[model samples]
Target: MSANIILFHSVLGLREHERHLAGKLGAAGHAVSLPDLYAGVATDDLEQGFAIKARIGWEVICQRARDALASTPGDTVLAGISMGAGVVASVWALRPLTAKVLLLHGLATVPANIRPGLPVQLHVADTDPFFPEPDVRAWQHAAEAAQTDVRIFRYPNSGHYFSDPALPDYNDTAAALLWQRVLAFLD
Candidate 1:
């Protein structure tokens, strides 16, 4: 069951990491779309990334995300990295038939209207500053309450964006495991 997937980039913008990931998914026989919400601007520093996001404005960013999904199927899988997870949440309710959600390095709200049994996979570092332990627990509980099938993978001692080799936070082992699980989930 190959899925049509729209993978959103992190606050750092649509860089090599996302393109590489999309290629990997494509190789696995899945249709992948990589959207550049930042309009070609990218930054490695978190603060600068947030500034870029702020300068573009949240509404515009989300509108771009929605626009990107316009060409895909309703059941297209929505995947995002870090701040991209929030982007997924923003547009989740609008796409009730989304096949599945893959949240990497962040957490997203489970919409009340989500289809029961819809699978959501979250991968984050245990001590990730962006996703504190308490918040992850709360998000999981909320998803469970919504009757959605949820799987949370916590990489102990890894960095927030541990899967991106371009960043200092990258963890080879954790990133490998994350991709393995993600591919299996898609299957």
Candidate 2:
């Protein structure tokens, strides 16, 4: 079940939860790269997180992501959380050889040209302010049009960032189920 994976962190930055996930993946014999899109800066404040993302600039973050992807295998699996999911989506088209995409807390459009059956998984809060139904629908439409093998895992009544234990939004049951599915997907 070994895989070469590139994991992007949320707008809050490369926090411990991202590291913990990387460790879990590594423990399962996967090689993962957890990039810090916000450099070394991190925060819990939503406003500050937005500020950090703006300061770094999305284009710059995308470039860094490209740099990080350059060293990985062509079939590398790309994984991300929240803002990181958006980041991965932005560059997915460029990496035509990407094997799979795993998104947490958000949904992003799969590249239109991706091969049919390219695996794509999204775990999101059903009523998340960050991922309203309309947005999810659009993402679903795009993936469907691309004929991707997509799976959407929804956690009802959960907060936007429910998977991270350090956040108040954390949901133990959902987090456990998420990991269970994620590990099996990677396997």
Candidate 3:
């Protein structure tokens, strides 16, 4: 029951953190593709990451995402990190048969035409400045209302990118727990 997954990187672009995760997923028997939407550009600074994203333009980024997805199966699981979650949202409607969605460090709009019983998991810091509590709640409610099975895991006191060890925001405990849950979700 291994899943075919298309994992989009954050605004910071595809880096070691995402490659490591892809390797982990591959080791776990899942087929994973990590798309480099930012081309070869990458940054450690969040502001610089956003700047790169702005320079790349949203339409181009999304088009890259869509193009990356073209070779995968229709039921491939859609996963993302931070800004990548927005990428997932941008293409979700076009892939109505998506098996599952893994949203890390950010929230994406739940498609109004989502398939019933689709599974979606979200991992984010409880107090992440980028994702306010009210917004997360609203996103969850909307997904649930759309008949999707949604699970939200919030890590208290952890920073937004707690899962990436290379980042200053990394939290070992939270990252371990996140991977544990994510592995189970993929299973």
Candidate 4:
């Protein structure tokens, strides 16, 4: 079946990390659209990228996310990497219930206003410095409490950004498996 997928990138913007994933998903027959949240922000340095992410802020990210959803098919699936995941969750929290959310490397802050039961999948490194097991457990609990069918995958030795080939944290094995799982999720 053909699916419509709305993919968001990490703070690094649209790069190889997700381009390949998008192509794979697209090739698999899913209509994928990746939005550039960092419209005015550009960074050649990793530190600058981090700073830019902090400066761009989540509100802007969420706005771009909403725009992405609006432009995509009505039944588009929300997919994002790291900070992008936060954007997806933000949309989901705001009653964008039509789109299912796929979170790669992070989770959202749950509240009662948002409805539960949205299908959510998370892919994180087991040793991910940013999202440790304890914190991920908390996130899992929140999603579960919301009755969301949350699927979490852990890569044993991969770093926080295991899916990004440009980063030192990249793990080929993890990246490959991640896409395989992601493709299945998209289907």
Among these predictions, the greatest lDDT belongs to: 3
lDDT of 4 by residue, 1-187 (tens): 7778888887777776577878878799988897888885554356777788788787877887787677666667877788777777687655545446778877666556544666678899999888889999998888788777778899988988887777888899998998889878777
C-alpha TM-score for every candidate: 0.98, 0.97, 0.99, 0.89
Badly placed stretches (over 4 Å) of model 4 are: 40-45, 111-117
Off by over 4 Å in 3: none
lDDT on C-alpha atoms for all candidate structures = 0.94, 0.89, 0.95, 0.77
Tens digits of per-residue lDDT for model 3 on 1-187? 7999999999899998899999999999999999899999998999999999999999999999999999999999999999999999999989999999999998989888999999999999998999989999999999999999999999998999999999999999999999999999999
Instruction: Report the alpha-carbon TM-score of model 2 versus the true structure.
Output: 0.97
- Model 1 backbone overlap count: 0
Clashes of each: 0, 0, 0, 0
Ten consecutive residues with minimal summed lDDT in candidate 1? 106-115
Candidate 1 vs 4: which has more TM-score:
1
User: Can you give the lDDT of residue 23 in candidate 3?
Assistant: 97
- Itemize residue pairs with steric clashes in candidate 2: none
TM-score between candidate 4 and the true structure: 0.89
Every model: Cα RMSD to truth? 0.7, 0.9, 0.6, 2.1
